[model samples]
Structure formats: C-alpha cells, structure tokens
Target: MKQLLILCCLCFLSAATLAQATWIWYPGDYEIWLSNRMQNRRTDRGTFFPVFWKMDSHYPLMDFHKDVTLSEPEQVRIYAEGTYNVKLDGQPFEGTPTVITIPAGKHRINVKVFSQATVPAIYIQGNKIISDSSWLVTYEDKEWIDETGKTSDITATKWLHAGSWNFNDPAILPSAFTLPVKPMAAVKTENGLIDFGKETFGYVKLNGIKGKGKITLYYGESKEEAMSDKGAVNVDWLTFDKAVSQDSTLPASKAFRYVRMVTAGDIHIDNVSMLYEYADVNEPGSFRCSDDELNQIYDVAKYTFHLNTREFFIDGIKRDRWVWSGDAYQSYLMNYYLFFDKGTVLRTIYALRGKDPVTSHINTIMDYTFYWFLGVYDYYMYTGDRTFIKEIYPRMQPLMDYCLGRRDKDGLMEGQVGDWIFIDWADGLSKKGPLSFEQLLFCRSLETMSLCADIAGNQPDAEKYRLLAADLKAKLFRIYWNDQKQALVHSTVNDDVTRYANMFAIFFDYFNAQQKEAVKHTVLLNDSIQHITTPYMRFYELEALCAMHEQSYVLKEIKNYWGGMLRLGATTFWEEYDPHESGPAHYAMYGREFGKSLCHAWGASPIYLLGKYYLGVKPTAPGYATYVVEPALGGLQWMEGTVPTPAGNISLHVSTKEMKITTAGGNGILRFGSSTRPTCTTGTIQQTKDNWYELSLSPGSTYVINYQSVK
Candidate 1:
C-alpha cells in the first residue's frame, strides 16, 4: 500500500514536469506581424519603399485559453503583450490580474488581448498549469453575450494550437525580438568615406561625433555606389546639435560594404563601425576538395546563403529584404544541406504562407505559389515532422483551391492581370499563354497537397488531390510533351521549348528514363535553346544535370560560372552573374547603378548541389529513418563533407581509390560503383548491379570500403 502511494506521487510529479510552458500566440499571427515590420524597413534612396502588393496585418483581437484538470490548486503568473483582460473559468477577473489563484478542479483559463500595431501574445507560468503550444488560441472566439448576461454558443469558433518558439523566459517578450549583432570595425577610411572591406548588413554606429551640423551618409553595396550619393539605395540624414561627443547608431539596418559620410556646418566624426546582424545558426555542413577554386566557390556560397538567412529566409540583404517564396524555396533546400535549422524553415514557410484569405499568389507570382507548396513537401520529407504538416495542411488546402479556381479554360495555370508570371529573370521570356513550367509546378503542388492531406488525416481531400494531381500529370505530358523536339515545350502558345520545364521534369521524376535522356540532350545541352541566366534556374538546371550523372560536367560548369564570380572579386554571390558583362556594368541592374544584390540567397545553390548530389545523403523515407548515401567524386581527386539530417549528421570522406562513411543516425544504404569488387569489413556487401556494390549501414557505425577506382 505504501509503494502504491509512492508510485502515484511519482506519476503526479512527472505530469507536472511535462507541463512546463513557453510564450504562445494565435498560430502564425506573430509571423505576419514580424514580416510586416521587417519588410517595411526597406528604404530606397532615403525614401520609404514598401512592397507593391497589399500588406497584411495580424488580427487586432485574440483570445487564448487552456482547459486544465489539476490535482491541487495552483497560483499562476501571467504576462501579456497589448491591452488584455483575464478570465478564470468563464468569470472575469475584475482587472488584468498578473497573478491569479484557481481552485483545484476542471477549469478553463482565458486571456483576450487587443493590439493594432503588434501581435497579441501571452506567457503564463505555474507548477501544473502553464502556457505553451498546447494551449488553444482563436482570433474570433465569438462568445457573444445577450442583455440577460447569458453568453451565446461558440461551437463554430475555430481554435488552433498556439504558435511558439524558444521564447521560454517570461521576462523576454516576443515583440522585443531582434537578431544578435557584433561590432565590426571598418577596414579602411578614405577621406571621410569608410569601407568595411566586404558587403555587409546591419546598423552603422558613428563614434565620438561632436559639434552642430547636418551629416548625410550614403550607404552602398559597392565602392562606386557609396560615392554616388544620389544613386545609393540607402541614405541617412542626421542633424546633430550636440555640445559633447556622443555616439550615434543608425535608426535602421542597411546593406553596405562602404559608407560615405558627408558633414556640413562644423560636424566632425572620429571612427566608424557596424553591428553585423545575423541569425544564430551553426555551420554543421562543410565541403573541401582537391580543387581550390571549387572550395572557394563553396565557402562564398555558404556566406551568401548565411547572410540572407535572417529573421526569415529573405531574398537578399541589399534590396527587397522580403521573404520571397521562390527564393525561400531554394534557401530551404540549401538550408537542409547546411544548417538544417528547422525553426528557420518553419518560420519562413509560415511567413510566406500568411493567413489564409487566399488573396493573390505568394509574392503575387504564380510559380512562387507553387514553390511554396513544394517547400512544404520538401520540409516534411527532410524533417519528417508530421505535426507541422497537421498544423499547416489547412493553409495548404486553401492555397491549392485558389490555384484550382484560377485555372484557364483548359485547366492550365496562366497569369492573370495582377499575377506576376515570374518563371525567371530572362529576356523576352514569353508568359502569354498557359506556360508549361507553371503547369509542371502546379501539378507537383497538387501532388504535395495529396501527400500533406494524407498526413493531415483528411482522406477524402487526399483522394481528391491525388486524382487532381494524376489528371494534371497526365495533361502535363499530353499537352506539353513534344515528340519531335523530345522535350516539354516552353509554352502551349507557339510550341517553343526551353530548359525550365525539361530540367525540372528531370529531377522531379516526371519523365521516364528515355524521355529524360532525350530532353537532357535536346534541351539541356542545346545552347540554341535560350540559356538560363539567373542562378535561380541554374539550381534546377544543374540539379537535372547531376541527376543524369553529369557530375563531372557539372563540376566544370560550377567552376566556370560560380568560379567566374570569384575571379571577379565576389565576396558573396550576385543576384545575377553574366560573364560577358564587364567593369562597373556588372553592378548595374534594373537600369540603376549598383542595383544588383551581391549576396542573393538563390545564388547559394552549391550548398544543395554538393550536399545532395556529391555527398549523396538524402532521405529515402521521411526524417532520415531510412536514407541513401552514394558519394560522387565529381572530377575531384578527393572530397569530404557532412550532410545534416533530422536524426544527426552523415559524414563522408571519398577518394578515387576508397571511401569512408559514418552516420550518427538512420539506416543508410551505401551504394557506389567500382572497377573491381568492393570489400567492407564492418558490413556485408552485395552486388546490386555490374560494377556496383551496396552495403547496409546502421546508426553510429563507420564503414570503410576498399575498391579499385572506376574512373
């Protein structure tokens, strides 16, 4: 009898421990609020430049509640942002009570808050009753009261699990969130102008400034841009009447490697420095090889990607610091191979897929909307977190419905008036009719919807989406596939064929082997076909090549293209790189001086290419429960790197003669080809095909394979 009592006490203690909580908000409300704050910070030539499309806001009023059945009475401390009212078990707490005592029983705690400028959020703490994502939150609780003081039914009101991150401490509010920063001194000062030696982002601080005067600071991503006061994208004008020397920090963060400070009326400054603001993510993935140029390209690509991975995965640091869906889609892929920061990926996905009124497409682009769906699909595939899918699936349904409603007479996606048909930033790219590329992406998105619906436990919707995807896939081939050309035509308009659809088809596995090989030669290698210019399309273009086992050829192309940027003194990759463009002409884009961003997120494709294709570590099943590791030398004498998975890291070292692999988690199949039979002492090797061998690998095991180099 005493032992039974002790077991009951232990179980009670465990239950209390499991109730530890963190900050909570209406799911995705904080993301929308924060994105608005971040995107509105853009300044062009000292003028406020905001998005051309309609901006969204969080619900001004929100109600959060949690039902608890406690073993004993508990005192709970409450903290909230915005004007709020507290209620205990459907009864009002006279005022906004910071501390409330509740009797032990089945009870519901509610906090309703209103804020026009910020998101409504709350943090609650107690021994057994605490606040976290487990709490239910609703923007419209709909508990209307009548004249008799009787509340109406709220059965129609929808409640979702509250959204949260690592904001566990009640002392720190979510509204006060900011990226961490560090001081960086200028590399050199040239007559009133200071250069930070490389393109950077963050607020600039002026140290030891004295006297009364007007100071104008021009910010630039390039040396020429800084000197061009009128052309600089960001500028700061400050009027100082200080009697004593005071340090001043800029009001907003700007992207610039150089700053030109022009002072008038006896204003003087001592030194210049900056607070380099960045996301706190560790570099778990690394790549090194015999080729120095490739290594340099990889390092610069990593830096470029990291710089753009801030509050959300933005497009670039210099201009339009917005969470673009298509750009973020690539960033997600690159992130999977690099930081594998699930928080950032989830944050970005939520921000891009803002609240579900399903107005215009994401970023007002058709292809981008499709990319958003694909991003969600890839997120589930890589992380294997079904909870996110369950939470996000509702949003996905409406988005797919929006696309379905917009289909043309033939049921293909075509650009409407407000929709931006941004396939790529190519010259004279036809977007007139229902482009095959859009249909291809739309088909894939439907497939994603089907997969997510299954995970979200909506079997009817899953079947609906599956049928839609199947029908669309059939149409994709029937309508777009051209036999004589042996490739998917660019558009149904004039039967023009481009690399976009064909390349995407290759990696998406939309094409069979015969069609894939045919398109690989006819479209990919066909220079007569309009060459893809942006690194964005190049990502898929190269992925298609690597998929076709053209890694050796891709190695040369990476060196020529990415390496060309390095030869041109690129501290980070460019928004677009054209080798033919010479001198300052390289800096000019959008018909403006220094308009091109030097650190674009989409340019960091090598992170994905090397990790997935070279290291060959990809999840066969979700969450790395089952995976495949097939390393490719890609013309390198030796290469080594780590690919991050939800389970852990898969490390690999490969040379021409032998290969070594170690994984921290997951069951992996190590497959490779050799001129002779490969020998593995730690595991049994089987001949999968002629000159190919496969070994089964378990978690935390290292395997060394001795083989004669096939190449």
Candidate 2:
C-alpha cells in the first residue's frame, strides 16, 4: 500500500512536470484549475519568505575559525586565537576570558565561531547566555578538539497560547504541578506574649482580610536565643496566600507567571525566616538561529509557543513547571516553520501527537495533521524541494485517513468535547462544537491529502478522500445553509451567528448561485478594486478569507490587519491582538497565550501572498501547464518583488498602465494555453485580451496598470 501510495505521488509529480516545465503554479494559466490546484496544495513549511532584509555590517556578525581556548584569564590572552565578534557590553572582545558587561534586560547577541584548521577547537559556553528561553552552563574551554561539539546553549523558559498560532510545530501535552497548602492560627499564651501557630494538616482560609499582618517566629528556650533574627538556612517564613513561596531548605526560585495559595494564614512558629528556592535549570541548549543576521527575524516566539499544548523545554526536555497556554500553541504551529529545521519541527509534532485528546494540549490528530501538512506544503513551496514530501508524506497518510475515513453515522467527523471539529473562529460560541466552517476546513485538509494521495499514486485512497470531501461539502451546506438569512449560519443551531461562514464557503467554492451571491453581499465589497475586508475580524481570520479568495474586500483589510499586529505589543506577529491592558499570563488562551513576541513567517504570508500576490503587487502563479497574467492590485503604494518560483525568478511589476512580467533574465517565455479565459479590463493595468505574452523587461523597472471598474 505504501509503495502504491509513493508511486501515485511520483506519478502525479511526473504528470505535473509533463504538463508544465515545472511542478509549481505560474501566473499565465487557466484561472480555475490552476488556482484550485494551487490552493489545494499544502502550505509552505519551514522555508524563509521571499522578502528579507539584507544583513548589514551594523548587524552583529560572526566568522568561524579553528583552534581556541578560555580555560583561564592567562589562557584567554594566549592560545585564544579564533575569529572575534563576540560583543560583551557593547565592546568587541576577542578570544576567551575577556570581561564584558551584560545589560540588565535580556540581550540577545549572535556568536559565529568556526574551525577550519585540521586540529579541532572548542568554544566554551558563556555566562548568562539566554537562548531557547533558558540559561546554559559554562563549559570549560579546552585545547583543539572535535568541531562537532559546538552546540546552541539558549533555551525557552515559558510557553504561551493566544489563538491559532503555535510556535512549535507538531505539539505535546501541557504540564501540570501540585504544591502543598497549609493552615494557620493565632493564640495568646500564658502571660502577655502572643504565640502564633501554623498547622500542616488543618484547613484555613484567608478570606476578607483587610490590613496587612505578620507572624514572627521564636526558636529556642529563652526569648533571646529563641527570637534571635539570625538562624539556619532551613529557617523560613511563609507569607499570606500567594502563587509562589520560598523554602529555606531549597534554593531560590520564582514562578513564570502565577502561583496560588490554597490556604492563607496569620500563623508563624519556631524555625522560620524568609528563604526562597530557585527553580533548577531544567532545560538546556539554545535556539537554532542565533546569528545577528537572523535575530531581527527571530523573536520571543522562537522561545515561546503561542498556541497548542507543548511545554517550552531545552533540547526537547521537560520543564519542572507548566510555562505556556493553549492559545499560544496554535499560533506557534501556524508560524514556527520560519526559523526551525524539519527534524526539530517533526520532533515537536511527534510530542503533540502523543498527547491525550481530552486535554486542550493536543486537540486531536485531525487538527494536528491538517496544520502539519500545511507547513509541509509550505516547505516544498518555498524551497521547491520534494525530499521532505517524499520522505514524510508516507507517515502523514494514516493521520490524513484518520481524519477523513473515520466518520459518524450522520456523516460527520467526530470531534472531542472542546475540540474544534470543523468550525472557523467565533463558532466556539456554539456549545454544540465545530460546525460547517470546521467541516469545510476538514474537507480542505482532505482535499490537500487527496492531492498528496493522488500524487503518491494511491488511486483507491485518492478516490476515497475525494468522495469524502465532496460528501462533506454537500453535508456542510445542507446543515448550515440558512434560506431566511440568505447566507450560511456560523452554526446550524444559531441564526444570529451568521457571519463570514459564507465567505469561506465562497472562498472554498462550496456554495451555489444564491449562496455565493448572499456571501458576496454580506462578506465582501469592491473598494477601489476587488479587495476583501473584515471590519470586526482579526488578521489571521482575514488571511484565511483572502487566501480562500474572499477577494472583494481584501485591500482595505490588508494594511489594517498587518498594522494591527504591530499595534499590539508585538515586535513581530502575535498569536492574537493584545488588548490595551494585558498581563503576561492574561493572554488569549490557557496553554499557549498570545503575548508571545517574535513571530514573522506566517504572519508575513498575507502581505506577500495576499497584498503582493493577489492584489497584483508582484506575485506569480506557476501554472499546471502555462502562465496566466491576471493581476489584482490592492491599495499598496507600489510593489515590485521576485519570488523563487520553480520556473526561475518570476519577476512581476505592477503600476498603472500595463502589467509586465519576465522570467529569469529574458530567456524564459510566458506561455498561456489556448484555453485561457478572458475577463473584463480593470485596475491600474488594462486587462489584456491576449492569452499570453513573451517579453523582456529591464532589471529594476516596473510595468503599470490603469484602474478600471469591476463590473
């Protein structure tokens, strides 16, 4: 079966190649089939986006050299010979044992050390190096050694969850902890002294207490020695109820966010002094991308997960505490591919897959696999590499089948209690759980799976999924369509919930005439051109709408959505928009919250794909057979960019007269099959009547298009 699947996929790739010079979609092609196939293709994975800043000299730079040491101060001045660029406290300190200042707030610096000499060398771990969200140990700097020993020391210390974002791909179950709660009391003994006492077993609640109070402990016989302030390390005092507490017997420590006290007290006894225990350094190692060049691209998100159920641990190790929330996990999953490797991403996914379905930590296999493929497809898209798909697609088959093949008698995919079966955002209000939108997403996932299956040559499986997808779409309409509202309801049980469900239905092309028109009316508007807008929705929600071709309102919402991400306290994209006042823990979800910073990859997709690609800025579609130049320019000042398409550099230039595109240098031709459809003229560039054009454009020059009505 696996071999057949592999063969089918190979055949599909072979067929696609035979149909066109390359396997990717291009601009000049039949609109319907090309768009459908491209949309159905898996999303790009851990590949870098086309748009990137060229790292300048000012950016922290690192060069590699062989042979070095930092065993001692004297050793630092002598024998410490390698490339410099390790800046400590803003001063360039070469070699090892150099004194450098560490700013108060966490500062991320890039380190580049290489060894080319035949004899190997070692780079000792520096002090207070914060990578991957955790501190790394200081290793002894030794003589020339094996070069493979160089490893990242930074690690993550916390986890977040706001919404759809999951910083770590795949995912794992969340962590849990338990602490002992004690009770307390106050009693005036014998003469005039007040001897306060605490009980380890009894229940005591500190409710409705106004002013501050404290209970001092007395140790030995007489009040002098017994009340001596100086005592043993084991001596400690327990303040009122709090999320954290100090133990004299243990090291000093602080909680990531919150700590709760089950019981409160006015009691203190003997052996007691303030003592804090530090949490052990549980995880080790640092992030994969620590170079200054990529630091701008890397953000707190690289250290934290926005959504999903994975704990932030160094080197894939477990933490002593639960550091993230569910909301952050989802955001991470959708965005983490920007800076990580496939193996790292796969490891993270495997952890999440192993999680219990009951806990929000893992959700279900369907949601995980669906998003996983989205990332995998992205990997293929940006890098134009098929090895990952060829190697990993087989493993993904069973998960895809589980989501599609397993069904209820009612023809519905089974979702857990809090699990989102097939609904988009906002439908969570439906107590019944995942509705039409959710099912639509499932169908979308199946569609992608079927594409993979067909490519893999699993004809029986491909037919099975295709049929299932068709049936699900039909069932989605029957169940959620509202004739009275003239649109699809957010859920079958609610009419007031009528929202952008129809937009997705239209975007997914899952509707009929009346339905499509109803959706077009309520969901989109032609502002300037066919630009889609979502007034009350979040940016990601809008991206799905735009990606799904809710094209009518895309332009107006594009800038606002991207701008909104910046407005939040995000240096890059966030799991969700953080309201004006939000604490570290008070984000959108309980497991992976949104306050996580440093997300750029997926969040930047709409700008490139929607604003740049769809809005006719500078984007191309690699056709299944030929090129189709259909430009839709949203309201961007002007966009000129080149994406690494399978057909070489597909350069698209859009202005206000004629849209011009050139492939490679001018060596490539824009071929449009005879079957190309001709639509009316609109936008800055006049829509051409010809199906194809082969032209040469000067480098750094642009093509223009004049604005026209959409009627």
> Each model's C-alpha lDDT?
0.89, 0.35
lDDT of 2 by residue, 83-172 (tens): 334543334566543434444443433333332321111122223221121212111222221223223333411111011111121121
How many angstroms is residue 636 displaced in model 2 relative to the true structure, after the best TM-score fit?
3.2
Candidate 1 residue lDDT tens string, 1-711: 999999999999865685567888987888888888899988887788898766777888989999989888998889988899999888999978999998999999999999887788988988778898889888885654333324467555677889998888888899999999999999999898899988889989999989999999998787888899678888888899989999998879988888998999987788999999999998898888899999999999998999999989999998889889999999999999999999989888888888758899999999999999999999999999999998898788788889999999888899998999998999988989999999999999999998998997778888998998899899999998999999999888889988899999999999999999999899999899998778999999999999998999999999999999889888889899999999889888899888898889999999999999988889999899899998888779999999998777889989998889988778989888899888889999999889988999999999899987677
Model 2: lDDT equals 0.35
TM-score of each: 0.95, 0.44
Which stretches in model 1 have alpha-carbon errors above 4 Å?
1-20, 141-154
| Best model number under TM-score | 1
- After superposition, the stretches of candidate 2 with alpha carbons farther than 4 Å from their true spots are 1-366, 373-387, 404-406, 417-428, 431-434, 495-500, 512-514, 523-540, 544-553, 564-570, 578-630, 658-660, 664-711
Model 1 gets an lDDT of 0.89
Each candidate: RMSD to true structure? 5.1, 22.6
Prediction 2 TM-score vs. true: 0.44
